[model samples]
Target chain A: EAGVAQSPRYKIIEKRQSVAFWCNPISGHATLYWYQQILGQGPKLLIQFQNNGVVDDSQLPKDRFSAERLKGVDSTLKIQPAKLEDSAVYLCASSFGRTGGKETQYFGPGTRLLVL
Target chain B: SQKIEQNSEALNIQEGKTATLTCNYTNYSPAYLQWYRQDPGRGPVFLLLIRENEKEKRKERLKVTFDTTLKQSLFHITASQPADSATYLCALGSDSWGKLQFGAGTQVVVTP
Candidate 1:
């Protein structure tokens, strides 16, 4: 079984520039998630998708950040007009959507975005 | 104002000793709490999960104790080794499906 895969392990962009991160979840996993982790902090949930439908995105910055899980397997998170404050690691994870049981999430090597 | 807090400072413990880490939260009633281990430059890996109804859960040398009334969780690694050095994160999962709130994470360093 393959683990969750992400592209561009590291990225650098200037302030006000746009950046995008992509994630390919584990096969047969029904749930996918995107999180942002600032230095010295835990990963913060940005968005969650269950079978192509968004389950939650309350912490997402609607003004600049957006994400989509197309066809329920591949997902992408984009931040337009990136700010220096957005310099942090973006993590992607996937889990089996099992009801009435604990779902353990498998994470991918995160993309480190450094905004100048 | 909901918040989950873990020790921001790194904990230094000698190998073969027990290492204990604490996670405390306020303003949230979580159905389950989870622990994850993360090394530098990598994502976190799930270690353990304890439900609200359960008082304690153990796996190998890892033990997690949850006290709902106190809103605290303690993670203990017995017979600890230098390989156990990493940042440990605590996450809260509420009744709302797929929602997990994480703390700032606590780093543990074990020296030989």
Candidate 2:
């Protein structure tokens, strides 16, 4: 079976520019997540979706960042007016289950974004 | 606030030796602790998961130990090889759901 897939493995943009990313989770996976990994730091959860419904997005910057999972399979994350600090690796992950215990998450290669 | 910490210093060891990495946490009680390996320009791949109730778990040459009392987890790679050179991250389910909080990770370099 194929793993999680993402597009535009690398991206470059200027500050205040807009950018978007796409993700396709593993087949039959029920939970999807987006994370931001800054250099030398672990990935931070930005948003989570379970079958096209958001489960958590408390850390997401609502003012400029937004994400949606349409049809419960494919998802998109967007950042408008990007800041230099926003330059990081955006990773998409999918899990076999919905809740915490015993569920394993599989990640994609990630989209590396650089804002000048 | 909850915090997870891994040694920022990179671990260097000779091939065929054992590599031990530590993960320490504060202000949180996680039911399960997970370990992942990430290569440069790639996403993290899950390696192991040890539960709070379980003291130790092993798979092949990899071993993980969880000490809930100390709120710490240790990951060990036995008979290490150069292929084991990667950044290893420790994570926990921060919420009741599967939302995870990850540590900064410890990079291990296994030299020939």
**Cα lDDT tens digits for candidate 1, B9-106:** 99999999999999999999989999999999999999999999999999999999999999999999999999999999999998545567889999
Candidate 1 lDDT over A28-109, as tens digits, reads 9998999999999999999999889998899999999999999999999999989999999999999886664367889999
Query: i-RMS, every candidate?
Result: 1.8, 1.4
Most DockQ-accurate candidate: 2
TM-score of each: 0.98, 0.98
Clash pairs for candidate 2: none
Q: Give the clashing pairs for model 1.
A: none
Candidate 2 lDDT score relative to the true structure: 0.94
CAPRI quality band, candidate 1? medium
DockQ of model 1 vs. true complex: 0.64
Q: How big is the positional error of residue A34 in model 2, measured in Å on the Cα after superposition? A: 0.2
Question: What global local distance difference test value does model 1 have?
Answer: 0.93
Off by over 4 Å in 1: none
TM-score of predicted structure 2: 0.98
Predictions' DockQ, in order: 0.64, 0.74
